[model samples]
Target chain A: MLVYIYDGSFPGLLTAIYESYYRREKPEEILAQDQWQHTLFAQEVVIKTDEKKADKVYQAIKDKISGFAARNAYCVFLAEVPGAEMLIYNYLSRGWKLGAKLDFHLADEAVLQVHTVAKKVRQEAHRMLGLVRFRLLKHELYYAQIEPDHNILQMISPHFARRMADQNWIIHDVKRGLAAVYNQVEWVLTPLERPKTISLDETGLFYESLWQKYFSSIAIKSRKNLRLQRSFLPKRYWKHLVEMDESRSRFAESSVLSPQSPVKTYK
Target chain B: MELLEKLEILANAAKYDVSCSSSGSTRKNKAGGLGNSYASGICHSWSEDGRCISLLKILLTNYCIYNCAYCVNRSSNDIPRAYFTPDEVAKLTVNFYRRNYIEGLFLSSAVITSPNHTMELLTETVRKLRNIHNFNGYIHLKAIPGADLELIKEAGSLVDRMSVNIELPSASGLKLLAPQKKQDLIIRPMDYIKLQIYEHKEERKISRKVSHFVPAGQTTQLIVGATPDTDLNILQLSEKIYKNYELKRVYYSAYVPVSEHPKLPQISQPPLLREHRLYQADWLLRFYGFRAEELLNESQPNFDLELDPKTNWALRNLHLFPVEINRADYETLLRVPGIGVKSAQRIIRARQVRAVTFDNLKKFGVVMKRAQFFITCRGKYGGQISLENKLLRQYLIAKPKPIQHSSPYEQLSLFNESVPSIPSEVMLSNLTGEL
Candidate 1:
């Protein structure tokens, strides 16, 4: 059995694919260098990332198979799940023969595997569009910390750049030690260390408290279903959300103080 | 009053309005604007009651003049009343939006002095947010029923969506519970907004420079289990509204008894399962190409408690069952018990390349448990039982066990409660009878 290994990068993966075709031999397994496990009987091949060769393979996939298949390959790489590299290699090998009709062959195991992994990555990126809560630090820099289940920092940053175009912000992924930093013009993804503590500005605390007040007051008392609530916003995401934390809400203390009158005029 | 206190009272008052969607708009941000609208809306959070918190749903004020029996903020209730200035509302929306805490603002209000006056307050707040704050987020404004047409038109041009709630299902029910509201008054603003949206779309076809007028279109809400209306009445009304006005959604809210009156039912719990059934039937009308009259009739006016609407319909019309999976078109496939829009489309796409087998159906996202009784693969039936309606129903009926609370101590505390817990079998029959 033959095994192929490359550095864990998108270009490196594409280069490995390029080698499997031109070398005229199909490897039994394709893995990233970090994920390689030693086996006694397998022949090992190491492949380096060549930019020109990776670009040729990328252009060939887009021109021969379809642009949609090219996007699916990129999303699967970002997913970084175990055995994803092998799935993409098999998908492209079959896609080269079927051309643009590759995705329509959903009954095939290779095509279905690529489509399913890409969908999971896209869904997590969409969820982070709403779950990232930003806090205002000193000097007016907006900072948000997220611990997404997948590597979605690059996937969701373009949305924030388009929506919050005039503000400087940073979305830090604490689990992966990565961040997407934006400077009101463009954004770049870089490695970032998680901070031990974070301090909010004066007005930040005020707005957070106000948001907590709105969150608690809007729930109907008669329809209290914690099971349903956990289904939508799962318990794993509660640590970062401001409204879900019990210690920060102060809801019980505030509701105890009764108002003076039911009718009051305001200017 | 502090702004925090006002927000508490007004937000609590507005919690009963359950139109929480912020979708169907693709409004782009200006060069230096603060935000933009998403095409498919993002739900920022879920409340404790399991509802999606997509927008900052609040009221500008809770002061009212009309006394509706079912409303918590009726004039005779003497609840805590507070108002926010237009500037205050604009500031709150911008701050909350900056923190990524909400998609936008869902500003509604009680009829303070008159419909026109109340509408002016709501419109002015949206205008301030757009012009002064340079905010381009999704905004859904409520159109006051008896307000002038000009006010409704102006509000429509500034917001992403507009709604005018038809609180009761029927005209007579509206009269019995809310004497001050008329059906004609509620529908006038809806009709006017529909015309304006049509005109805006036509103008945009001529030139791309025309601005949007309610790009997300209109939606409305109706209270369930409050009047003597059946599920048939609610579904037919929704069908008429969707056909005539081209509404994006019609939210059905189970009546959470805020104040008791002689006209309202004395039930302790809301009819949530009935509301869920109505939503299911509504989806069949909108997406599955099923008509209202086809799903329910005078003989059987409500959905079965153990089965969803689609399964019930399939069970009644057993002649249509055993549809050949390879030969059935998209519409026929949609009528099957467990086949949905996504799976039906997947089957169509997958069949173009290869013949789909029964084993391959599950990979395309088809739920074979309910579908096995209704579909065939290459002229061979996959169901385990004989094709009889009664036996098929017995096999298909979802037997959801009564939810067991974790602790026996909690069940013991319920012994002193006024309402006795009914057995699951009796409760199921009772729910079907009541609906």
Candidate 2:
């Protein structure tokens, strides 16, 4: 059995795909260097990433197959699921043969597998778009920490860059030690660690309190369904969400006047 | 009032309005702007009640002039009243948006002085958010029913979506519950917004430079179980509203009994099951191509408590069953009980490459338990027994639970019990006898 191994990068995977065709040998497994396990009887080939070769494969996928197929390959690479490298290789191998009709062949197991994995990656990115909660830092830098299931920092940053064009923000993916940092102009993905001893300014605390109050007050007590809430915003994501912090009891008294309290009528 | 206190009161007041969707508007962020609108709306959080908190839904004020029996903010009620200035609302929206806590603002209001006065305040809040704050986020403004057309039009152009709640399903219900609100007064703004949206679409076709007017289109809410309106009445009214106004959505909020009025029904819990059924039937009307008359007639005024509207329809119309999976058209496949829009489309796409066997149906996301009775794979029936309506319904009726008074609010677990397993072979012999 022939096993192909490459560094765990999108370009590295693409370069490996290009080499497979140039070498004219179908490997039993395509794996990242870290994920490859040695087998006593298997032959191993290490593929170094070449930008030129990677670009050829990417452009061919776009020009020959379709832009959608190219996007699916990129998203599946970002998914980082086990055996994802082999899945994308198999998917693209068929894509080269069938051209644009590859995705339409949903009956094909490899084609269906590629579409499903890509969809899951895209869905996670879209979910993270809403789940991210930014906190105001001292220097007016907005910082949000997320521990998403997938490596979606690059996928969702373009959305925030467009939405928060006037502000500087950093979306830190705590799980992957990656961050998409934006400075009112453009964004760049870089390795970042969880900041130690993070502090919130006075207004930051004030707005956080206000948001927590709004979140709890917005829920109707009679219709409370924690099960349904968990289904949408899972408990796993509750760690970073400001509104979901259990330490800050939503029912804690902040004022003498409750929501049910009668106030002086304004007529 | 402190901002926190005001939000607590106002958000609690606005929780009854169930239209929290921030979708269908593609408002892009301008240069140096603080935010943009997502075409498919994002839910920042899910509240304890399981509803998506997409936008920061709040009322400008809870102070009112006219007393509506169903409204918590009605003048006769003694709830705490508070109002946010236009600037304060805009500032709150920008701050929350900056923190990525909400998609945008869903600004509603009670009639503080008059409908026109309240409309002006709502309009001013959105205008401040758009122009002064340079915030291009999704904004859904509630259109005051009796407000002037010019005021409504101006507000519509500024916001992503606008809505005027129909309040009650029937005209008599409106008269009984909210006497000051006439039927025509409630509908006039809706008509005007509909006309303006249609006109804006035509204008955009001619020139791309034309600005959007209610770009997400208008939606409205009808309070269920507040009056004696039947499921038929509600569905028929929704059909008319969809046809006449061309609304993007019609939200059906189960009447949460807030105020105890002599005219109101003395129900302890909100009729959530009924509301769920209405939403299911409404989905059929909108997406599944089912008509109101087809789902419910004069003989059946209410939806079946055990079966969903689609399953119920399929059971009643048994002649259309055992549809050939490979040959059935998309519309015919959609009529199957368990085949939804996504799975039906999947089946169509899958069949283009290879014939879909019954074993392959599950992979395509088709629920075989209910669909087994209705669909065929290569002229072979999947159901164990013959396709008799009575026998099929016996297998299909959802487990009977306490319908009205359940407190934990469990979603109806449909088809929980396993059906008789499909036999391994010899199904073609009974294929002719089954149907």
Candidate 3:
């Protein structure tokens, strides 16, 4: 069994893929070196991150599968799953070999699993579209931050930049310390400093108040269901939700004052 | 008032309209437009009801001259109302779009001043978004009932989709709930939009170069449980809209009991599960080749609440099942309980190569537990011993008790403990390899 290791970056992963195909090694035999713990009897090779090697792999993937599939494969790799390295390598090798006919065969567990992961990532990307709330900062750059479950900041940036082609806005993936900034006409990705807690501006808070008031006013009093609302946009996300403070506060106040049932209220 | 305040007020007011989805359309960026419409589905935010928040689901103004009892923004309601200038709305849309907050704008209103006045403001906003702003993203404008025909046609040219809410199904209900709104006013414009879409289609077929109009098509929403209308009436209305108007969708919003109006039903909560069931039924009618007459007739008004519409229909007609998987036609396969459109397609496609067995069906991601009873594998039966196994049917639908094997819960706990060592995005992305 040949075990392959890389620097645990996207380019590094691509390079490893290049090597696996180059050496004609089965993907199952390949193991990420960081994950490899001295397998008693296997040939191991460390794949250096090379742009040329990555490009070669990318070209090969595009040639075999659609560019869409290749990009999806890269996105799957970005997920950073434990067995993802081997799984993707296997999926690519097998998928390419099978050709376009591979889509007809969802029978393969590896193909099905990878497809499911891709779908989940896509679903999260879509959900973030609705859940993401922006805060206007002091710089006039409409700023917002998100701690997404997936690396979706890049996936979501182009849509915003094209639609908002006259204003500057920055969407910082605070958890990843990566940001996508659009300056009216174009957008680019940038890395932020060791991310600390960002202070909410007064206008941000004011918007929060207004938004909260708006949300409360629209919610049907007779149909208010906190449990269900919390299920989708979990309470943990409420702190960032502009319209959520008053509801949570109201709940707290009611619990303190009346305790049981607490009398559900909405405007 | 400043533009921001107006935006907040109007956007907030407009939030109640439910058809803001950016899905079901495939408009790409044209010569001058900014963003493109995604056919694969976009703008997937959900309200508290877990409904999709696709477009900027907001109104131009909550201030109204009409007093619809079901609507919170009715003019008579002593609520803090606001209105947005055409520029303010355009700016908010640009900002929201720039931030990736909304697909475009879902600009609805409460008949501010009059229908014509509200319609004029809306048409102006959409025109600016399309021509002045050169924004081509998806714009779903609410066509105000009783608005001028010329204004409606002009607005339709600038937007991707348009809707005129049939808040109530019948004329009597409309009169009872919303005294100001007339059936003719809403239906007439819908008739006009339908004719326009038809004419546009015919023109495209011949000319092949005329710019597409209402590319996303038209859709309407019916506030269910608000009036004493049954599922049959609602489905019938939806069917008519789909057939006559060529509407893209008929959204059924389970009426949230908000106000204590004399004409309204004194219910505690909206029939959410029922609304969900309607969506399922609607999907079946649209995609699965099922008809309204087949699912619900004059006798059976409401859908079965316990079992889903498909499952209920399948149960009521059981002799149709146990059809041969490899040989049964697409329609026959679709009729089988627990078999969806995707699953049926999978069966058809996979069976072309080899005869699909029980094992093969499972491999194709079929829910075998539910399907096991209804299918025979290569003339072999593994279903209930007796054809009339009522207890078995109950068991099939019964909830399963907790049983831990590989223990995904434990795995998740371990994952949570280790997450602090690495970034959550990378960690989640790596696990599923999705992002």
Instruction: Going through the candidates in order, state the TM-score of chain A alone for each one.
Output: 0.90, 0.90, 0.80
True-structure RMSD, every candidate: 11.0, 11.4, 12.5
DockQ of each: 0.64, 0.63, 0.17
lDDT of each: 0.89, 0.88, 0.72
Q: Pick the candidate with the highest DockQ.
A: 1
Ranking of predictions according to TM-score: 1, 2, 3
* Residue-wise C-alpha lDDT for candidate 2, range A83-120, written one tens digit per residue: 88889999999998988878777778899899899999
Candidate number achieving the greatest lDDT relative to the actual structure: 1
- TM-score, every prediction: 0.91, 0.91, 0.80
Per-residue C-alpha lDDT of model 1 across residues B107-145, encoded as one tens digit per residue: 999998899999999999999999999999999999999
Order the numbered candidates by DockQ, best leading: 1, 2, 3
DockQ of model 2, rounded to 2 decimals: 0.63
lDDT measured at residue A203 in model 3 versus the true structure, 0 to 100: 54
Write the residue-wise lDDT of candidate 3 on B1-435 in tens digits.
865466556655665566756665666665535666776456433355444445666777777888889987877888777777788778667655544545777878888777898899999998887777777678888898888889998888778888989888888999998988889888998999988877888999999786667778888988888898888888888888888888898988888766788888888878888888899889988988888888888888899887778877777777776788888899888877767778889888777755777876776667776777787777877665444677755856777777768754444465464544568788889999897
Evaluation by TM-score, superior candidate among 1 and 2: 1
Off by over 4 Å in 2: A37-39, A246-267, B207-209, B398-435
